[model samples]
Structures are given as structure tokens and as C-alpha cells.
Target chain A: MPITTCVFDAYGTLFDVNAAAAQAADDPDFPRLADLWPAVARDWRRKQLEYTWLRAVADRHCDFWQVTQDGLDWALAAQGLDDPALRARLLALYRQLPTYAEVPAMLAALKARGLTTAILSNGSPDMLNAAVASAGIAPQLDAILSVETVGVFKPHARVYDLVGAQFGCAKDEVLFVSSNGWDAAGAAGYGFRTIWVNRAGDPPDRLYADPHHTLGNLVSIPDLL
Target chain B: MPITTCVFDAYGTLFDVNAAAAQAADDPDFPRLADLWPAVARDWRRKQLEYTWLRAVADRHCDFWQVTQDGLDWALAAQGLDDPALRARLLALYRQLPTYAEVPAMLAALKARGLTTAILSNGSPDMLNAAVASAGIAPQLDAILSVETVGVFKPHARVYDLVGAQFGCAKDEVLFVSSNGWDAAGAAGYGFRTIWVNRAGDPPDRLYADPHHTLGNLVSIPDLL
Candidate 1:
């Protein structure tokens, strides 16, 4: 079958996780955060994804919200700066992250082209909803999916199965997009056509199938087909 | 029944992965390697482990040797240094990488106490055999196990099953040891009594289960039980 639907990874793909750290600059409590935020954000996102995979492998499922908080706490401790206010503010920022400017336009363009577009993420339903609504991109998406329904994280086959189940389409007919190369590899290995948004220019993850398409940002996604 | 068998993760736990890159300091071609080797080794090991997990999740299993080489290649590219002879020499160094100072004595103590000892690692059979023989610790082990039998990497339940299957013991009757906190978590989650060798003073991986015992190195393993 020809491609009929597009599924995106929520965190790094559709939402900018580092944007939450930018809010730290306004907080006088974290004087060093302006310079440290980038590394902290990277560590937090790495731990978040790692926790999801660890929990899945251990047969212990926690919502992505808890994982996100745990990841933030780890990142803070690793950086050796502890402030209750800064912690709370950073987490609050996560609930409403900024998106790539091309996100809404791309989703709209996909819909306009008659392609069904949805998000397939390890994020919790509440987290996804708040992020989508806060970014003003909720109205443009056909569906907002979360791993909570299945109680496992992405890169797991069952997580990918949720997309086909939702849209009633074959795996190959659903186009998967993720900024995370590991997630892209997993989706492609699961039989979806994957577009890896390598915004950071990292090497391809060598453990899984390579993504079908590679692009720098969401600006190129609408024209990917 | 009480724990009867002790299994160890080979690469970082028993053998020093960094030792290979340190050998590069002896090479005339890479004179700047002394300071660069540690960071390069860290990146290489990180990518190697990530590939193992990603491969396991993607159902695209390859032997650990390939993963190790792929990881080293990526680390080299990231460092923007390319030399075929340097790569070959580094890989050759891996087959006889240095072991922890206390490993042989600890294994001897376990044997003298009439406890069974073995190695449960992601290493390929040849790599494990060569390392154990070179370290003069092969006679100390009753079994040399690999993930090849299970076709997956650690943290996957099946890989842990290889240990129990070889020893004909229940999961709880086996004690697993690893320097990697993530590996310890997987063993604990799989129902084995775990000892995390925290030689680097790193924080525990905030993933799932915690190890049953924590020690600075193999020097503490014999006294653990």
C-alpha cells in the first residue's frame, strides 16, 4: 500500500526539550544555568529515554511524567546545583515546551495533502496533551498517542503496534518520524518507513535498521514523500 | 536454596576496556593519544553498550565484537582521526586487555569456598576465551557464557537466562556481578542477587531495581557472601 499516515515522536521530534531549559535563564536562583543548561538538557533527555527503556526491559512500567521528573532530578544532582524552586520551574516548563516553527505548518500541509497525521510517543497522555495544546498544534493533529495505554516505552514492538492499531493501516503504510536515531531505527526495524531528523548531526545508531529517509529538521518533512 | 553460583560481566567489570586505548600511547602514529584515550574509550564503551541494547530491542542481534568495532569507529570519527593501522592495533589490544588486580584472587577464594564461579558476558566466545586465558583466570571459571546463545544483549531477560540455563540453577540461586550499574539493574530485575562494582564512584543508574550489594571493586566480591 502507498503511504497513508504519518506518526511522529513527540519529545525531540515535535517538541523542543531544550527549550524548557531556556526558561532557566530568567531564574536568578540558577545563576550558572545560562551556560550549563545545554549540557543539563542533554543529560536530562538522555536519562529520560534510558529510564523508559530500562523500565520496559525490567517489566516495571512507569508513566513518562515520572520518568521525566526522575531524569530532571538526576541531571540536577549531576550538575551539583540544588534548588527547589529551580527544579519546580524547570519541570513546569516541560509541560509546555516550544516546537519547531515548521511543525504546525508541516502537519497542516500533511493533512492538506490528505495524509492522516498522528504522534507516537513514549510520553504520557497528559504530557502529550499539555505540550500539544501549549504549542497550539493540537488542532492540526489527527491523533495524540501515548505509551501509557500499553504500559511500555518506545523501541519496543508493542509501542509501534499502537499506531497501526489506531489508524487501521499496515505498518509500512505509516511513516514514522523521530529526532532520536535509536527510536527511528526501532520504527524502521518494526517495518515502518522512518525519517530521522538528525538536528544534532550525530552518527546513526548502529544497533538497528537504518532510517529510510534522513533530514535536518521538520521543514523538510512535508516534502519527504 | 542459598546462592551457589557467581557470574560476572566480563568487559568493564573484569577486564579494563580503557586499557586498549591506553596502548595507543605506545604507538608512534598517535602520539597525542595519552590524554585523548580516556575520553575516546569512554565514548567507545558508551556507544558499544547503547548498540547492544538497541540491537536487542530492534531484534537485530550481532555479536559484541562487531558492536565494539563499530563503536570504536564512531568514536574515532567523532574525534576526526582516521588510521587503519591505529584501529587494528587498538582492536588487537582488546583481546588481551588488562584485568582488575583482584579478579584472580577473588575467583580463587570463591572456588576454595566450594562456590561455583563463571563469566556471563556480552563478549563473543573467542574474545572471552582469549581474555580469560591471557589473564590466567580461565581455570578459575567453571563456565564461560556469552549472549550469542540467546541472540540478545544484557538487560533482556533471555540473556540472563543463559546463566541459569548453563548452571541448571534458578535465577535466585545465582549471584550476578557487574561494574555497569545498568547491568546490575537487569540482573536484579531478572531475580539474581546483584553486586555492583562501582569502581568509578558513579551514581547508581536510576532505572529500575538496585543491586543487592555495592562494592568498590572485585576485592570486595569474595567477602560479599
Candidate 2:
């Protein structure tokens, strides 16, 4: 089936999840974080995803914002760094994560192709909105579907159901894109034509399914169409 | 309610998850793996749990043995090592992982107290059986429940339901112990009085619920009574 809708994951796929800590490290105020930010950012993103999956399986549904904070707290504690001000700054930065350099043109190219574009993310509505608005690509998106609507997280089948609910597209008629290998794999298992934008050249996740395509970044996403 | 049943997560809780890799590292035939084994073991365990949670959320059920191999593959590839012989050796070792020092005595202690002792694990029947028989703790355990029965992994509610189905015990009447902080949290959220065996002294997982007790090892488990 031809792709009718192009769906993207919000945090690491469209926005730079590493921006918060990287930005904090660059700021003159947080000198101590200069050497520690990368590890912290990696941990923050890892724990955030882990919490979402754990909560989903455990039937404990919470919004992404709380999960994000919980993740940051764990990341900070792991590093033995306990500065509340740094925590606040890192979270505030996460609220408006900078989009990748090619995000605007990539979304615009998909839109120009007359394909429906949207985001299906574990992010809460407020966080997704803040990110979309900050990146100024809200106009290009037909919908921003958050797992909050279903009170669960990916790679839950219900979370993937949001795409069909919003666009009324068949599973195979959607091109699901995510930077997370497991997310792409889950979408594939759910029967979507999936693309994994493997920015770090990480190995494919050992999951039930594999993405149909693997690209180095979103820059070539439009080309795949 | 008093604890009538004592259920433990088998792999890391009773069995030392690192034993396979650590043992492999000690073998003279694998002298090159001495420095690399620890990171490989950590990645293997992390990916194994991540796959379980992902598969559970995605509704793609596979046996734990496959998950174990997949995890080991990822870990091996991450370290840029590829040897079919080494891979086979690791899987062989995993089938008979050593139980923690205190597991046999602890189960014996629980049995002496007339508490119904059992294992609730993601391990498949054959794997769990192999480990149980190898450890000679088959006589100590009243029941061994695997997620294969439910076709999903923890911390799914259904996985926990197996405990009650087998033991006929109330959630509050069971003491759920796990080395995984998340598993402990999941059990706690499921209404079990949970104990987190924090052997590594890691911080508590930032989940909806927290384990009721934290201990350095399982040796003191009977002391709680």
C-alpha cells in the first residue's frame, strides 16, 4: 500500500533529546556540568524510556512530564550531582528541545509530497505542543498524537492505535519513523512500514520485528518516499 | 496480613546473573575476555529486560531463552566481538547459572518457617528447570512460575496474577522479592508487600510504587519474619 501518513516520534526522532544537558553544559552558570552532561543526558533519556515501559506494563499510567523529571532525577543521582538549580534548568531546556537541523525541511518536504504528517509520541500533550511550537513546524503537522490520550506509552498496541484513529489509515498505509530502534521495531510489528533513523549507528534492537528501512538521519527521510 | 508465601524473581534475585560471563572470563581458554566480560554482562542483562518489557508492551511474546540469546548477541556486538564458539559457550553457561550464596539456605529457612516458597520468573520452563535442578533447590521451592504461561513478561499484571493462581495467596499475603528495582516497584504497585534486594546499592527506580524493604542480600530475608 502507498504511504498515506508519515508519523514521527517526538523526542529523539524529531527533537534533539541531548540538547538539554548539552545546552546546560555550554551555559556559563553550570561549569561543573561541563564534563558530566553527556553521560547525564544519555542516562536521562534511557531512564525516561525505561520508566514509560515499566509504568505501561505495571498499569501505572503517568504523564511524560513526570516521567521526564523522574528520569532526570535518577540521572543526576547516578552522577552524584545534586543541584536543584541544575535540575530545574535541565528540565526547562527539555520542555523546548531544539529540533534537528533538517527537521523543518524534512517535514516540509513530506508535506509538499501531499502526504499527511503527524507525530505519535509518548510525550504528553503539553510537552509535544511546546516542542512543536518552539520548532515552528506545527503548521506542517496534521496531528500531534500523544500517548496521554490513551494513558499508556509505546510500544503498546494502543499507543500505535492513535495513528489509525487520527488519520483513519490502515497500518500498512503509514510510514512510522523513530530514532529508537525498539520503537521502529514495534511499529513494524504493528504492521507499519517503519524507518529507523539510527543517528548513532547502533545495532538493530533484538525485537520481534525490524524496521523496513534504516537511515543515518532525517535528512534522507524524504528521499525514501 | 502476615506473609504466607515468599516469591522471588529467579535470574538475578536468586541466581547471580553475572555468573556466566564471570565464569567464562575465568576460563583459560577465554583469556582475551577478562577485561571485556563485565560490560558485556551488564549490557546482556539490560537488553534482556528491555526486550521483555518491549515484547510485553508490543504483545509479541517469545520465550525467555530467545531473549537471553538476543541480549547476548547485542552485548557481544556492542563490544565488537563476534565468535560463534564464544556465543555458544555463553548460552551453555546461562542455562546453569549459579545461585547466589544464600539462596539455598534462604529457601530452606523459608521452608522451615512453613512459608510456601516459589519463584516467579521470566525464565522459560526449561531454563528455569535447568537452573533449579543445577542449584539443587528444586526441593526447596513449592512452585516455579514462568511468564510463558501468560505469554507476556513482567511487570505486566497478568504475570503477577500467576503467583496468586499457583499459590492461592492474597497479594498482601505474599512477599515479592527481586534484585531488579523495577520488578520490586511493579510488585509493590500490584499490592504485594515487596522487598527490593538492592545488592548493588543502586538507587530506587523512579516508578509509581517503591519496594517496602531494601536489603544488601537475601541472607537476612528470614530475619524479617
Candidate 3:
């Protein structure tokens, strides 16, 4: 099926998830993060994703913003950096994360080609709005779907259902892109033509389905279409 | 309600999850693991639980044994340990992992008090049977429940349902214990009195529910009753 809609996972895919910590580390005020930011970033992202999956399975639905804060708390504590000020700064930065260098143009090219584009994320609606507005890419997106509407997180069939519900596209007529191997695999299993943007060169997850294509970045996303 | 049944998570609770890697590291043949065993064990356990949660949310059910091996593969690759022999040896060690020093005594004490004792775990039946038998604690456990019977992994309500289904007890009548804070929290959400065996001194998970009690080890479990 020719792709009619392109759905992207927001956090790690369109927005650089590590940018908040990386940005905070650059600030002279947070001297502690200069060497510790990478670990904090890695653990924060890992715990955030883990919390979503746990909540999804446990039937404990919460907003991704709350989960993001919970994750940052765990990550900060894990690294023994217990400063509440640093925590607040990191979260503020997370709300307006910098998009990947190619996101705006690549998304624009897809729009120019008359293909529908949307973000299907575990993020809350407000968080997604802040991110889209901050990145100035709202015009490029036809819709921004969050898991909050369904009261569940990603990899759940319910979350994926929002895609076809919004676009009126068949499962096969969507190209789902994500930076997470598990999310891409989950989308693949849900029958979307999936692309795993493997930014970190990680190994493939041994999941139920394999992504149709893997790319190093989104610069080549327009080419794939 | 008084606790009539005592249910414990198998891996990392009754059984020492790190023992296999720690044992393998002591072997002269695997010189590489002497210093790296802790990282391998930590990553392996984290990925194992993460895969379970992912598969659970995605509705892609697989046996815990498969998830275990998949997790091991990810951990090994992360540590740059690519030896197939080492991989095989690790899997062999995992099948009969050592029980925590206090597990046998702890379970026996609960059984002596006329409380129904069992293990509720994501481990496949065969794997759970092997571990239980290997630990020589099979006599103390009235039932060994595995997620394979329900075709789902834990923190899912269905997996927890196995506990009451097997013993014909009310959710409140059961005392659920898990080494994982999220698991304990999940059981709490499921309406069972929960205890989080915080072996690692880790921070509390900011999940929907908190474990009713926290203990350093299973040794103090019987006293709680």
C-alpha cells in the first residue's frame, strides 16, 4: 500500500530527548552536570519509557508529563544529584526540547508532497502542543495525537488506533517512524509500514516484528517516501 | 483482611538473580566477567523486566525464558562480550540460579503458620519448575504459578489473577512481595497488600500505588505477619 499518512513518535524521534540534559550541562550554574549529564540523560529517558510500559500494563494511566517528572526524579536520585533546582531546570528544558536539525524541512517536504503528517506520542496533549509550538512545526502537522485521549500509552493497540481514526487510513497505508527500537517494532506489529530511525546505532530489539527500514537520521526520511 | 496466602515473585526475590553471572565470573575460563559481572547482571535484569513490560503492553506475549535470553543478548552486546560459549554458559547457569540464602527458611516459616505459599512470576512453567526444584524449595511452595498459563507477563492484572485463581482467595487475603518496586506497586494497585523487598536500596518508583511495606530482605517476611 502506498503510504497516505506519516506518523512519528515525538520524544527521541522528532525531538532530541537528550537535549535537555545536554543543554543543562552546558550551563555554568549546573556545574555538577558537566560530566554527569550523559548518564542522567540516558537513565532519565530509559526510566521514562519504562514507566510508560509499566503503567500501560498495570492499568495505571497517567500523563507523560507526570511520568517525565517521575523519570527525572529517579534519574537524578540514581546519580546522587538531589538538587531540586537542577531538576526544575531540566524539566523546563524538556518541555521545549530542540527538534532534530532536519525535522522542520523534512516534515515540510512531506506536507508539500501532499502526504498527511501527524505525531502519535505517549506525551500529554499539552506537552505535545508545547513541543510543536516551540519547534514552530505546528503548520507542518495535520494532527498531534497523544495517548491521553485513550488513557493509555504507546505499543497499546488503542494508542495505535488513534492513527487510523484520525487519518481514515488503513493500517498498511501509514509509515510509522520512531527512534526507539521497541516503539518501531510495536508499530510494525500493529501492521504499519514502519521505519526505525536508529540514531544511536543500537542493536535490533528481539520483538515480534521488524521495522521495514532503519535509518541513521531523519534527513533521509523524505527520500524514503 | 488477614493474609491467608503469601505470594512471592520468583526471580530477584526468592532466587538470587545475580548469582548466575556472579558464579560465571568466578570461573577461570571466563576472565572477562571477573570485573564486568555486575554490569552484565544489572543490564540483563533491567532489559528482562523491560521486555516483559513492552511485550505485555504491545499484546505480543512470549515466554519469560525467551525474554530472558533476549535480555542476555542485549546485555552481552552492550558489554562487547560476543563469545557464544560464554553466552551458552550463562544461560545454563540461569536455569538453576541459586536461591537467596533466606528464601528456603522464609517460605518454610510462612508455610508453618498455615499460610498458603506460592510463587507468582513471569517465568515460564518449565523454567520456574527448574528453578524451584533446583533451589529445593518446591516442598514449601503449595503452587508455582507462571505467566505462561495466561499467555502474559506480570504487572498485568491477568497475571496477578492467576494468584487468586489458583488458591481461591480474595485479593486482599493475599500478601504479594516482589524485589522490583514497580511490581510491588502494581500488586498494591491490584488491591493486594504488597511488600517491596528493596535489596538495592533504590529510590521508590513514582507509580500509581506504593508498596505497603519495604524490607531489606525476605528474612523479615514471616515477622510481618
Candidate 4:
């Protein structure tokens, strides 16, 4: 089936998770702490995903901001780096993350092609909005939906339902793009047409849900659509 | 609040994931595909976790054996390694994984101390039984339970509930131990006295359900109990 609306996952898809960490690593002001930033970033991402899965199974809901902070705290302690100010700055950077180089141009292309572009993220509404606003790409979106409204994270069918409900389309009509393999598989399992943005060259998850398309980056998405 | 029972997570906690892959890597007989083994193992582990989470949320049930095979198949394709005999042999090795050096002695210590020891794992019943039997550790366990009966994976309260149900004790009387930080947090959150086996020095999850104790390895679990 032909795809109509295109929904993108926010983190690691549209935004670069390592950019802030890489920048921090290169900063002369914090030489000793520089070595720990990448590990910290990786742990933070791991914790975020772990929290989302745990909360979903526990039937608990918290805003992504809270989870992000919780993950950051764990990472900080794990890395044995306990500077509160540095921790605060790293988190602040997350809230105001820059979009991937291809995001704005790709969104523009999708819009020009008369396709609706939206963000279906695990991010909280405020987090997603602030990120889009800071990146100056809020105007490019037809809608910004978050798992917070549904009280569950992505890969949960109800979270995906929010998109179909809002757009008045079947799941298959939506082309969902995600840099996270599990998220792509989840959306595919939920019956959405899926594209996996293999940004890091990570292997595809070995589950039943296979992506309908795969690309190295979002830059190729517009052409595929 | 003393722990009267010590429950162990089966995979990775007692069994090494990399051992089989390492063996495969060193096989002169299969030199052409040996290097791909680690990636295959990593992807297989990743997919196994993904399937468990997805199936739990979907209210679906499949034995861990089924999920393990599915994961292995996906890993093979993702790595472009498609030897059926090699895949079968690797998986067969998984069924008879060697327990970590500390596992038997630690269980013996717990047994000598008159504390109950059990296998509370995400493995299917048959898989868990076969592994215990093959590892020659069956005599050490008071009971072996799997999430297969509950139709959900660990981090789900129902899976943890099996412990209390089987022992006729409150959750707090049992101390659940896992190398997986997320499982430790889940068991802690479900009200078990928890001990995290931090074999890899990974940080605690920001699960809000912190383990009561953390040890470098299972070598000290009996002392804690």
C-alpha cells in the first residue's frame, strides 16, 4: 500500500544523541570529565530505554523528562562522575537537542510533496515541543504526538493508535521512521509501513517485525516516499 | 527483612552468553564464518529481550525456546550467516551452557547455611530444567520456575509472583539475584529483597526499586544471605 502520512521518532532519528556528548568531550573547560562523556551518553540512552520498558510492564507512567533525569543520575553515578552542574548541563542540552543535519531538509521535502509530517515520539509533549522549537522545525510538522498522552511508550499499540486516531487513517497508511530498531519493529508489528534509519550501523533486531524499507539516514526517506 | 531464599537468574547470571560465541570464534573448522559469531550472539541476545518485552505488552505467550530460535534466525540473516547446522549446534550449546565458576559453590554455601535456593528465570520450564540437569546443578535447586507459566517475561509482577506462590512466602522473604540490572530493579519493585550481581560493574538502573544489596559477583551472595 502507498504511504500517506510520515511519522518520525524523535531521539536518535531526528536528533543526534552523541552530538552534545561529543561537544562536551572536546570542550577545554572540562578535560578530566571529557573522557567519561560518551560512556555517560551511552548509559543514559540504555537507562532511558530500560525505564520505558519497565514502566510499561509495571503499568506505571512518568513523563520522559523524569525518566531522562533518572537515567542521567544512574549514568553519572555509574561513571563515578558526581558534578551536579555538569549533570544539569548535559540534561539541559538534551532538552534543546539539535536536529540531525538531514531532518529539516527532509521535512521540507515531505511537506513540499504534499505529505503530512508528524513526530510520534517517546518524548513528553513539552520535551518534543521544546526540541522542535529550538531546532526551528516546529512549523514543519502537521502534528506532534507523544506517548505521554496515552500513558505508555512506543511499541505499545495504544501509543501508535494515537497517530491513526489523530490522522483518521489505518496503520498501514502511516509510514513510520525510526532510528531505533526495536521501535521500527514495534511500529511494523502494529501494522504501520516502517522504515529503519540505520544511523549507527547497528544490526537489525531479530524479531518477527521487519521494516518495509531500510536507509542509512532520513535524507533518503523523502525519495523513498 | 532478612532474605531466607536466594533466587538466581539463569542466563548471563549463571551462564555466559559469550562462551559459545567465543568457542565458535576459535573453531579452525569454521574459519570462514568464525568472526561473525560475536555479532550473532549479541544480536540474538538483543532480539530475545525484544521479543519478551513485545510479547508481554501484546498479552501474547510463547515459550522462551521459540523466542530463542526466532532470535537466532534473525541474527543469522542480519549477519549474513545462514548455516543451519552451525545455528543448530550453537543453540544446542546454549541448552547445555556451563554455569559460571562461582554458581555451584555459591549454591552449595546457601544450601549448607540452610537457606533455600531456586532458579527464577525467564527461561522456559523445559529449557531451565534441561540446563540445570546438564549443568549438574539440579540437586542444588529447591524449585525451578519460568515465566512460561505466567505468559510474560521478568519485570512483570506476575512472573515474580510465582516465587511467592511456589514457596508460600511473602515476596520480601525471597532475595532475587540477577546480572541484568533491569530484572533486579523489577524484582525489587515487586517487593522482593533484591541483590544485584554486578559482574560487569554496570550501574544500577534508576528503577526507583533499588536492590537492597549489590555485590561484585555471586561469590558473596551466600555470605549476604
lDDT of 2 by residue, B1-225 (tens): 999999999999999999999999998877768999999999999999999998887778899999999999999998887888888998999999999998899999999999999999999999999999999999999999999998989999999999899978889999999999999999999999999998887777899999999999999999897
lDDT (10s digit) by residue, model 4, range A1-225: 678899999999999977766766676766756788888889788778878877888776788888999988888888788877777778878988888898899999999999988999989989998999999998789999999888987678899899888999878789999999888888888889999999777667756578888899988788887
Task: State which candidate, 3 or 4, has the greater lDDT.
Answer: 3
Candidate 4: stretches off by over 4 Å = A33-36, B1-3, B32-47, B58-61, B70-85
By DockQ, the best candidate is 2
Better of 2 and 4 by TM-score: 2
Q: Worst ten-residue run, lDDT, model 1 chain B?
A: B51-60
Better of 1 and 4 by DockQ: 4
Q: How much TM-score does chain B earn in each model?
A: 0.97, 0.98, 0.98, 0.95
Residue B56: error of model 2 in Å?
0.7
CA-lDDT, candidates in order: 0.86, 0.92, 0.93, 0.83
TM-score of each: 0.93, 0.97, 0.96, 0.91
Q: On residues A1-225, what C-alpha lDDT tens digit does candidate 2 reach at each position?
A: 888899999999999999999999998888989999999998999899999999887778999999999999999998888999999999999989999999999999999999999999999999999999998999999999999899989999998999999988899899999999999999998999999999998878888999999999999888788
Which structure is stronger by lDDT: 1 or 4?
A: 1
TM-score leader: 2
| Candidate 1 chain A weakest ten by summed lDDT | A50-59
Alpha carbon lDDT at A120, candidate 2: 96
Model 3, B136-191: lDDT tens digits are 99999999998898998888999899988998999999999999998999899999
Model 2 residue B127 lDDT? Answer: 97
Candidate 4 residue pairs in clash (backbone atoms < 3 Å)? none
Q: Taking the tens digit of each residue's C-alpha lDDT, what string does model 4 give over B125-208? A: 888888899889888899998887888887888999998888888787888888888888888888888888888787667876
On DockQ, the stronger of 1 and 2 is: 2
